[model samples]
Target: MRRHKEHSRRLPAGPRQTGPRALSGRLPGAVAVVAAAALALAGCSGSSSSSSSASATGSPQASGSPQVSGSPQASPTPGQQNGGTQLQDAYQTVIANVLPSVVQITTGESLGSGIVYDDKGDIVTNAHVVGTATTFTVTLANSTTALDATLVGSYPDSDLAVIKLSSPPSGLKPASFGDSSKVQLGQITLAMGSPLGLTSSVTQGIVSAVGRTVTEPQGPGSPGATIGNMVQTSAAINPGNSGGALTNLDSQVIGINTLAATEPQTNGAAAPGIGFAIPASTITNIANQLIKQGKVTNSGRAALGVTARTSFNQQFQPAGAVIVSVTPGGAAASAGLQAGDVITKIDDTQVDSLNALTTALASLTPGRNVTVTYTRGGTTKTVDVSLGELGTP
Candidate 1:
C-alpha cells in the first residue's frame, strides 16, 4: 500500500507525517512534523515567509490572480451575451462583497491571509499563520496601509486563531458567515487570500466534498492534530493563503482555507487543485470561543495523555509510538503505560505509526476503557485503560 503523507499548510519546518495506513497509504514521519507543531504550540518565534506590499490595489488584475475557471473563455456571441453578462455580473458582485473582508496578515517576517471577523476589528486566521507572534501588521483589501493587530486568542487544536486590530480603520466591513450545514458538493466557491504573499488574490472552484477527515499538526494531545468534518474544494490554496476565506457565490464565508494535498511520490508535489478548508461551523464555533474566553473550554474531542513519536523495532521497519513522555497520572500512566514501552495497538486497530495511534485514540471517548496492546522487553502485553477528557495543558 502507498503511504499517506499529511502536511500542515506551511510551517517553514517542512511537511511531516508518513503512515502505512494513512489515506490507505504510508505517511511522512511524525518525529519531524510533531516538533514543528510543538514549537507552534509553544508560540516559539518563526521566520516569516515572503512579505508583500501592495503594488496596485483597486482590484486584482485579471492576468495575475486566480479565478473561477482556468480556461480562456470564448467571446460571447450576441445570442449568448445575456447569460454571460449575468454570470460576469454575479462574479463581480461577490468579489466586491468579499474583498473588503479578506486581508493580508504579517507576523514578524511571515505573511498569511485573514478575514475581518466582526465590527470590533477582530480578524480570524490559521493559528500557524500567527505562529508565536501576538502582534501583527494587517493590510486591508484594496488598501496598502498596514495596521497594528494583537492576538485575541488561539486554538491550535483546530488550527484557528483570532486577532484584533489595535484600532479599527474607518470603513471596516465584517464578513457575513454562512451556515456550513448548507454547503453542498458542486457549489461554487472563491478562495480569497494572499497566496504566495500576493495580497487580495482569489481562486475559484466548486466544493469537491464536505465532511472530509484530515489530521494535520495541532490538538490537545501532544504532537497530534486532527480536524474532521472539513470542506474539500478544488480551489488553489497555496502558501500565504492560510487563514483566508472560502466564500460561496452569495458572498457568504463558508470555510477557512487551510491545507492543500501534498503527494509524496512525486517528490512532495502538491496535488493540483486539491485543497482543504476548516468548515465554517468549526471556525465559527472555535473562533467565537477564542475571542470571548481567550481559550477553549469544551473542545468536545478525545485524547490520550501521552506524547509519542514513531519508533522502530529490531526489524528496523515501522513499529509504533515509543512513549517519549507520558503525562503522569494521565490515561496511559493510569493504565500502567510507561516510557520505552512500544504501543502496538489500541482496541482492534493495529498501530503502525504515531499517526495511526493518534487516529485510533481520537476515535475513542476519553472515559471509555479500551484494550491497549504494547511491547516491553520484546514481550507483548495488554492492559485496559480508562481514557480521560482531552483538556488544555
Candidate 2:
C-alpha cells in the first residue's frame, strides 16, 4: 500500500516535511497550468481546452485572460438551455454572496487565505497562515486598501486560528456556516481563497468524499495536526488557499480549505483535485473557542496523557515507545502506568514509535476504554486505560 503525502497551503517560505512520508512545498515561482476544459452542460456539444500560465502573483491565466480558442458552437434544446442557465446563475449568485467574506491574509513571512467570521471583524484561518506572527495585513475582496489585524488566538492542534481587524470597516458580511455533517457526496462546492497570492480566486468542483482523516507533516510553520472527519473535495487547492472558504450552492461555508495531497512519486508535486478542508463544524468549534477564550480550553481530541519517545532494542531497532514522564493524576497515572514503561500496543494496534502511538490515539475517542500493552522492568503487562482529551499546550 502506498502512503499519501499532505502539504499545507501557505505560499512562499513555508516549511516542508522531510522523510519517507514527508511533503514538499511548491516553489515560489512554480508554474501550474490549470486546464480549463469547456463544459458540456445540458447536452451542449464540442469541447475546448484553455491553458492558463502561472503568473508572478501565483494566479494562472490565459494569455488573453478572457479569450478561449475553438469556442463550442452547438445549439441546445429549450430544456437544456433552462437547466444550464439555472446552474450558471446559481454559481454566479453564490460567488457574489460569499466572495466578499473571503480575504487575503499576509504575514510578512508567508501568504494565505482567510474568511470573515463575524461582524466584529474576527477572521478565521489556518494556524500555519499566521505562523508565529501576531500582526498581519489583510486585503478584502474588490478592494486594495490593506487593513491591519492582530491574532486573537490559535489552536494548532486543529490547524485553526482567529484574528481581529484593528478597526473593522463597515458593511463586513460574515459568512454563514453550513452543517458539514449534512454535506453529501457529489454536492457542488466552490473554493474561495487567495491561491499563489492571487486574491479572490475561485475554483469549482464536487464533494469528492467526506469523513477523511489526514495528518499534516510536522515541521517549522507546519502544525502536524492529525485532523479527523475532514471533507475531501475535487477542487484545485494551490498554495495560498489555506484558511479560505469552501461553500455550497446555498452560499453557506461548508469547510475551510487547508491542504492538498502531494505525490511522492512525482517529486512532491500536488496531486490535482485531491484537496482536503477542515469541515465547518470543526472550524466553528475551534474558531469560536479561540475567539471567546483566548485559548482552547476543551480540545475534543484524544490522548494517553504521557510524554514518550521511541525506544530501541539491543540491535538499535525501534522496539516500542518508552514513557518519559506521566502526567500527574492523568489517564496513564490513574491507570497505574509509570515512567520508563515501554508501550508496545493499544488494543490490537502495534505501536513501535511515538508517531505510531500518536496516529493510533488520533483514531480513538476520549473517555473510551482500551487495553494497553506495555513492558516495565522486563515484565510485560496489560492494563485497561480510559483515554483522555488532548488540550492545547
Pick the lDDT winner. Answer: 2
Pairs with steric clashes in candidate 2: none
* lDDT accuracy of residue 201 in candidate 2: 95
lDDT of 2 by residue, 291-334 (tens): 99898867777888999999999999999999999998789999
lDDT of 1: 0.80
Clashes of each: 17, 0
Give one digit per residue, the lDDT tens place, for model 1 in 157-265.
7788899999898789989999989999999999998877677888999999997767774522113366777899999888788889999999999999988877665
lDDT of 1 at 148: 95
**Lowest summed lDDT window (length 10), candidate 2:** 31-40
lDDT of 2 at 99: 100
Worst ten-residue run, lDDT, model 1?
47-56
Cα deviation of 224, candidate 1, in Å: 7.4
Alpha-carbon lDDT of model 2: 0.84
